[model samples]
Target: MTTTTATAEATTATDVLIVGAGPTGLTLACTLARAGAAVRIIDKSPEPHRASRGKGLNQRSRELFDDLGAGAEAAAWGTERVTLRKYRDGVAIADTVAFGDRTPTPDTPYASGLLIPQWRTEEVLRRTLARYGVEPEFGRELTGFTQGADGVVATLADGRRIKAAYLVGCDGGRSPVRKALDVTFEGRTDTEECMVIGDVRVDGLDPAYWHQWFDEDAAVMLCPFRGSTHWQLQGMPERDADGRALPPSLESFQRLVDRCSRRTDIRLSDPTWFSVYRINVRMADRFRTGRVLLAGDAAHVHSIAGGLGMNTGIQDAFNLGWKLAYVVRGLASPGLLDTYEEERLPVAAWTLGLTEERLRAVTEGVKQAGVGTEAVVTDDVTTLGVGYSWSSLAWGGAKAGERAPDGPCGDGRLFDVFAGPHFTLLGFGRGSAQALAEAGEKCADRLRTCLVDDPTGHARRAYGIGEGEDALVLVRPDNHIALSAGADRGAEIADRLLRLGR
Candidate 1:
């Protein structure tokens, strides 16, 4: 049912084909390939560019990378910010708040945001892929595609073709693959303010703390970057008597900074790169069409209010990776695909609402002419708060338990189950070991089972796992619990895993 055109010279067939080589695409390719998938990634660009955008990686994204065996590289590239300070009209308002401590999560490791440019992140992921002997197929582009029940026939712009079982569109806002799927990206664009984003070396700004400056006229934000002396400055350019957009120039930017900071003597230099973009909160009505799907910007686009854009995309890949691997390995049913939208769609909507609320608060604060200090930047409302309610794969109700929370468990040392690639069974009483041992055998080729033993039992109370409880929990490989049947229902856990995809 699939055919390759003469142009796809790299291979006759690929298990998974990904369009676009941005962070989201590359991350999905990496996840799929690492699990023994034959993944091929193509981008129109011949090489990666030097433009530095999205200066901060939220807590959820950092944790995902750590799980994929690249945490050290991420740490080497980013500096941690311990304190967050708020400013008002060139004067101090509320003191700095300590919000940088990493916390426990259901599946991931990183608990705080790390300062790093978008390019640096791609570099690490590229290297990680190279280690596995899979180089990205750059300079190639997808022109058209036809889908069938078995696979898809994708044509290349240069007359080449490839047959793939599945395809993920990680391309940016203007995604060709998403267009081919005929999905509607529903949302509106806000032109009130276009952000001028850039990274540079500043002569005298402390990197340990994040600083914000707010004034009646304009605002200035300076945050720490991975490299020494380099800082990301997002400045609102000054306008004339007319309300026309100001041409963002060096002197104009400096004057705005000086007027807000009251530091006219401070000199600035070395402009790396700058761009103006109006943030649009948009998304596809459906995440997947047949075997072709979307993630990251291809699926959702929103403001930088929570620094959660890229992080949400990365987590989306994480959420899909394990499921795809299991289904590809013939261990789960195809029914798993529906859960992707049911779980992630609502999360994206919540994030859009939260970011809009944050933007509104900042706009109101600007009208009042005070620094929008309390409007904390985050994309977590979309990234971390994601949970599945309508998933046929997940057991629903209080019997469904509290959608599984992340906290300190086991012996004294804190641990998260996802430190390894496996499904975890959390129990408060006896009979859990037996339940998992049985599920492990039934889905031995698909799910790896682990029992999180917490003698202290605080974890049980926190997750509503009652003491002397007689229930057996079934967590997916991605760390989301699929079922929480009582101890008498251990056999049902394995049954659910086997019958889930059908």
Candidate 2:
């Protein structure tokens, strides 16, 4: 039997209960609300985090931000690339660009990586979510919870009880929610390596260039963060004069800069935020149990290499958000929720391998005079190539489970049509419009139809449609290809849509 606290300080109910206020939780909460599901998010932190951690977003993540209505804000808050300048013993060793030049195609408008502090990104998301009248409840920590066959009852630190249809753990690496689920976080923590990272104000450093100084036994890097006067400082200390570990304070940071840069010209002061980061590589053995699930760092934690940690978490929330919303709204079967783990877990495992390789390459290069240690922002890191062709829900299309490529349709773009909480069907050539209209009419509230005649074949080319063959492409609310079929398969696609909620 479900229990409720009567005459308690507060008792609430919601469709989804999110247990963190970070980017992952915030993104999921906002997505759920936009999809017309009731959501409540809570955080243990009393105030918004001020640290400038996880300061990069790949191309795919930028597209997601655009879809979430925070794209313009994110673009305005970040720069494309901040060049990295490396120095050894006060002499310039190499200067390299962090991102490569990848030109935008018709199907891919956002083709480059973005650099924005994680705090600012969260601020944008939170501000957007506020427009929906949903805000994170601060100082409310999840103490424990119990799940029955029907729903979950979440308990908070302050004696409030919440009955939610589903609960999610977007809490960080040391997630209390993950622990309550009894899931093992299997991975290695590098006790041998530690880096002190913080946002600091320094004198005599150009804000345009990310500067790194590497000496025989000491290393320090300072990168300018956009929209702020502070630079993010990262350093590894060899040992103090007494052969002890260095303290994580402004004075010690100054010592690191002086020792590594071999100059007193640059001075460090006024550290606003700081943390000692030990590299950890781990993933939860299971992402879901009963009515509870995990996303972001609570599900998987990656090394800082390739800057995949935050971006992956943000994407994870995006992937699960629409599915959760659909299931909660009774528009889709509960089995849809199972696909969240099926799709995201393998991606997390792939990211772990990629980041591990990058970390190894960088460390090996650093040991060998920093010659080959330049971090390359490749296509893989941009995550444009990520696809799920193997998913069981995918069907009949040449690009099933692939990212629904954006293209020109009528006077606007494909994404503009895919925007909002609705699946989209695009049909091309003769008889396509009627077929798509018939299918779309069946799910009028949840589906939108678009037609492209493409007399000159631009739209057809962008969508990879061939000559003499009309095409039907179905895009999920998250902008991934769900099914692709010949124009004749419209009835078949409609049948599939009708079965979605069964």
lDDT of 1: 0.69
Q: After superposition on all CA atoms, what RMSD does each candidate show versus the true structure?
A: 3.8, 2.9
Distance (Å) between predicted and true CA of 401, model 2?
1.0
Per-model TM-score, in order, reads 0.87, 0.94
Candidate 1 shows a clash count of: 12
lDDT of 2: 0.84
Q: Backbone clashes per model, in order?
A: 12, 0
Candidate 2, pairs of clashing residues: none
Error of 2 at 328 (Å): 1.1
The parts of candidate 1 lying over 4 Å away from their true place are: 1-12, 85-95, 98-111, 238-242, 366-370, 377-383, 397-403, 407-416
lDDT per residue (tens digit) for residues 1-502 in model 1: 2223323333328778888887888778778777777788888888885556766667657766866777779889886654655667666565444344445444344556676888888888888878777888888878887777777778888988778778788888888877777789999997876766565566666667666787666678776665646667787866668766676666766776788788765556777766676879898899988777888889999887766778777877877877676666666677777677777777778777877887776677655433453455453442444666566666743435223555555642223454444566655466677876776787776566556666666566655666777566666655566777676666776676677667
The best candidate by TM-score is: 2
